[model samples]
Target: MTNPTSPRRHLPTSPFRTAAPPPAKRFAVGDRVSHDEFGLGRAISVEGDGTIAVLVDFGSRQERITAPFAKLFLL
Candidate 1:
């Protein structure tokens, strides 16, 4: 039995809890990248010391993805 007033603890293997956010992804100009929804692209411009946003050219369009990019990955 557990104390009703006690704060619940997160299990080490708990899938519902996130121990830590994934590391921030960094990109540089001319880098190749793939996006979950945008397909393959090439980095055109980077801003804010590579911590703010990255401008990428996806051939058909360009996107400005902000920091902590979840769907963007370097190739």
Candidate 2:
């Protein structure tokens, strides 16, 4: 059980979970990527620091996806 105040609690007894969270995902212009729902596409442009949102060209249509990018993945 956990609360909104602290979603993840790290214990000293656990060695594996002690490491910091994974680094943020980064995408460059023209970087090929795939989305769970958007099929496949190339990154058209990156908004802000590239972590806030990403504009992707998914063939038939373009969509703006924001973080945390749960479905977005680099190809």
Q: Against the true structure, what is every candidate's RMSD?
A: 6.8, 4.7
lDDT, residue 55, candidate 2: 97
lDDT of each: 0.89, 0.90
The residue-level lDDT of candidate 1 at 62 comes to 100
| Highest TM-score against the true fold, candidate | 2
Per-residue alpha-carbon lDDT of candidate 1 for residues 1-75, written as tens digits (9 for 90 to 100): 889999678888988965675666778999999999999999999998677899999999999999788889999
Clashing pairs in 1: none
What lDDT, from 0 to 1, does candidate 2 have? 0.90
Candidate 2: tens digits of C-alpha lDDT, residues 5-70:
965767889867566778898887899999999899999999877888999999999999998889
Weakest 10 consecutive residues of candidate 2 by summed lDDT: 1-10
TM-score, cand. 1: 0.69
Tell me the lDDT of model 2 at 56. 97
> CA lDDT of 71 in candidate 2?
99
